[model samples]
Target: MIKFTLVLFVLVSGALFLFGSSASAQNGTLFFSPATGSFAQDDSFWVNVMVNTQGEDVNAVAAYFTYPEDKLEAREINTANSAMTLFAEKKYGQGRVEISGGKPTPGFSGIQQIASVLFRVKSSSGAATLTFASDSAVLTDAGNANILNLVASGKGAYVLKAKSSASSSPTPRPSSSVSPTPTTSSQPAPSSFPTSQPQFSLSDVRVDTITGESARIAWVTSEGANSVVEYGPNKEYAFIVLRGELAMEHQITLENLSPQTEYHFRVKGTNAADKELQSEDQVFTTGALQTQQGKEEKGIFGGRGLFIGGIIGAILMLLMLVMVIARKRGESSLFSQE
Candidate 1:
């Protein structure tokens, strides 16, 4: 009886351990669509926040996003066709925005669209980033249990270019009496002036160090020139990095990047003669979010295996106990007959 009781206790304890570990191991991801892009000054654009449950059913979500107030203005929040049945939003400070909402019943599974925010560009010519404040963000299951540990990645950015003055309608020139005499003949000699613009080249453009949240880019120019880097998640370069100084070598670091993401970038330089040069677009991808996720998965599977083994061992022990009782009863009956 004692042996049978001990076996049952072990089985129950192992099953409980396995269930707890598996519950905590589930993970998910939240990200933005049209992650990177460029816009002209005063141009309006929209970004959508998305969630991938990663096989986990999530019922509630809270996201906090921020941008450069001087460069962008949050215009509106759209929740049409979103997975969220009810939502509330708030805007604060220069460019901080917060959104919290959830589906009432059944929650959400697989990939879901949360909300979309519209923004208008304000900066004349510069780059700005839209970042998710992970510390303040939260994701929960149907029971309102915090599951933020499952969030793998969520960060993004945008760049704005000032409208060129040349593109605008030209102002009419004032007529003046100073337009006196026109010269009939005087072609300057070719030797008296430089014919072509200065020639230079950009080389060795590469991504130096990349992490889940940042990246560093470096390159060399044949001549000293002002350095600029335009990059984005796609071929359309939308973000710009300016050194604002002349140099033969240049390096720029981009921050607030998402993990397991691919980015496209190109180099630009302006020589002393004001001639501009651009390089071909290049690409780089950030590191994956596997370290923590891998450990969680392992723990869950290992716990399950242990639980199954414990159940099997408990059944075998019960069978042995029954066999021993049967043998003892038979021997006692035979002795009584003798």
Candidate 2:
């Protein structure tokens, strides 16, 4: 038992993003490039969050932004050519899009692209606001401290016109030269905009294989909508997971969890035209991580498989010592006590 405990102790080893202001600072800037725009209903547009570390060597970033579910539908998140080469998460739902990503050892500085979100105008002739959540952060590689200063970190407002008629000319999106805060005065919806909103519904909702540390939820909607999964250790779930881009089919992964815990989770999706669909609270006990020679076989570690090898080596050493002691005792018996 002592030996086993020692082996366990030896095997267990401890292992251990973006927010803030639109304007560049000593720490960094976490803001969308084109802060304001206008579009007709059903028209799609893209906006991206950019960062400038300003000579600060930072490694990881996380951004959380919210839009009006009634007016705009998030379709997808694009990371191609993004400075954050590794993404810890990409999620959107309930008019919220969250992205947490990072780079390798030396970290990154200067100007770079974080992520691009494609949004489709859904509601007719309404004002929409997409702004960064205060919880967003840009973490330093050294200490992982959040250095984003969000005091007046810009906000983006958009005007949604009714779908253009045959003779109407689409209003060109405004320039980015001015403060783009969301307000009714910034750009008002035309008087001809549609007034009816929708009550959305969903189908084919399912929860897939939930492992020790991650849970996957999937659902289908008649129309493209944002996806959000709320999960926690119990019924009062405070954690949120989102997949911002809107689509009829949605899949979301909830990770970083404790094993053997009973977690309560629910799914919420909002489609264009101010419609929402939700699932009843569900429960599931998490599972233990599957491993070959003990310890995680795959995951964030990405190690060289040294843990199992050390355990095996320790066991062999113990066995050899026990054999040697037994042999010496046999020899001390002096041929059956002759």
Candidate 3:
């Protein structure tokens, strides 16, 4: 009877392990769209990093990845039309790119495209693969923690074929070998230059108030971002202050300024993807200092008034002495005549 009961329990456990979708499955599955493809050298393509929340409400997502630098180069990240409005960080360089985005609770569910990366092929007749780093995460809104875990099973693989004859001449071997490295860089993307990077736009930047001793600045963003204010006596921006919280409205105050002086300033902040961006050069002149400097100016003018009053009194006393001397001389002359 004991052996039969043990056998029954084993069979039931096996059935649950094969069919269960809760604990036995990873709640979040991160993957790339168009997981496999083929392209020629210098051909540009885009790959999207997607996430499936698996019915769990996830608030944050981080997708940092690496590719073979020898075969591919990441060009840019575009989030213009994406669902995510808050981007914490976006970086691409040295054959690696990272993108982080999230929203406040109650979080997001279902399949979502976090961001898209554009790449240019460098090698001909070879393969390239893009894989996510181990530390990437999809944080849940609840406490069970990944509840289970996350997986990056949908890696992107591509084949780089030889360039077409017209676009790329094959006979010049030296140039072909050296051209791959600089070809993409030489392509002028004037229109997309500014937007190609992971940068945020700052609007309604206002100097709320500027006093001799302190100044306040306020600005707004399209989405949540960190706050940064840089100000100095010149464009060099000698002073910098920042607040690391994520919010749509931002304000920063700068203190200890010289009265009646011009200060050059600019504001910097991060997008939902954590890409740093700065505003144009701005100018603000401090009004008269309210406290110690005001007293000092009054003292300076007061000294000048006292000095002028002393000169006038000395001239009047000299004139009065002369008049008294002339009267005494006339009286002496009259006495002698009498």
Candidate 4:
């Protein structure tokens, strides 16, 4: 009986030791770039996913995460099958292998803590949200050291700032004074021109019936300035350089486009002072190859010139008829007098 009791005590001690090691071995962390969680389409961006292997030391890390396909575009990630690399190897003390989709959770919530994380995103407006939920993952063993989960999750969003000279806030100034005499005086108003920054806007846009090559663009401005355009086929602009030129007028014709292709585009307006204002971007596709150009054609007779001529001719004919009737009545009166 004494021998059996001693054996049981030894087994319990070994089990507790294993459990303690597993609990202390796991960790997780998340990192992103641009400081502001936003990115432009066709722009390159990244999400650095890391895991802390308590003290056991790890040779590899594997993780999984979900993402919102509508708002973000993902490139390569740092994992077994992605664009990222092993952020830190097993020898770097406790560090993470940058994975593509691993996300972080708020530290305090139980449900949020255990959730799997994923993704760095790019958007049209350079704005989007990255979210994580309550989920669990399995930690595989590298060799002797077993890993415990230190799962974490949190929220991140992306936003693109507009380039405008317009004031984001109201400007303050001292009040004007008037003389005590019975005379009135007027002061010239301050000018909105030569502002520290310029303002921009886009409007009156139309697509052509031909291939994506031609697009008609027009817009208004508070201050007159030149314009520029940036556009491409993809949501992200990694492989292509910006396409732009200098011009005036609220209208322009864009030509040489691909058929049935989707494009994203934005405009920048510059003032005389060389200040720039940015307009919100928009997307469009070239019409079918067989579609006719312009909404409708104008006929010559239906034009203003023909209509004006017809009005003049009708007035002249009415005057001639009235003069003929007056002459006939005057001649009949002279015949009766004779």
The most accurate candidate by TM-score is 1
lDDT of prediction 2: 0.70
Pairs of colliding residues, candidate 1: none
Maximum-lDDT candidate: 3
Deviation in angstroms for 174 in model 3?
29
- Per-residue CA lDDT of model 1 for 1-338, tens digit only, reads 66754554354334333332334444555666655566889899988776656556666666667889999988888888688775544344568877666665567765567788888999987777877775333344544444454245455556678886665434432232333222212335543454564347778988899988678999888788776677788987645555546798898886656798899988887765445677898998988655887878788776998878889999999999999999999999999999
Runs in model 1 with CA error above 4 Å?
1-23, 90-93, 136-138, 149-151, 169-338
lDDT of 3: 0.72
Candidate 4, number of clashes: 27
> How close to the true structure is residue 204 of candidate 2, measured as C-alpha lDDT?
75
Q: Write one digit per residue (lDDT tens) for candidate 2, span 1-338.
A: 66754443232211011223323343456766455567898899998777656557787777788999888899999999588776756788789998876776678865567888999999888788888887777776666656675553545667788875654433433443243555445555643253454336787767787899777888888788777677787776645555555798889876666887888888876665545677888887779867674555453255546766777899999999999999999998987798
Ranking 3 against 4 by TM-score, winner: 3
Tens digits of per-residue lDDT for model 4, 87-170: 221111111221212212211211111112233333454445443322222232333222434243323345633443244323
Question: Could you tally the backbone clashes for each prediction?
Answer: 0, 19, 8, 27
Lowest lDDT 10-residue stretch of candidate 2: 9-18
TM-score for each prediction? 0.43, 0.43, 0.41, 0.26
Worst 10 residues of 3 by lDDT: 12-21
Ten-residue region with minimum lDDT total, candidate 1: 176-185
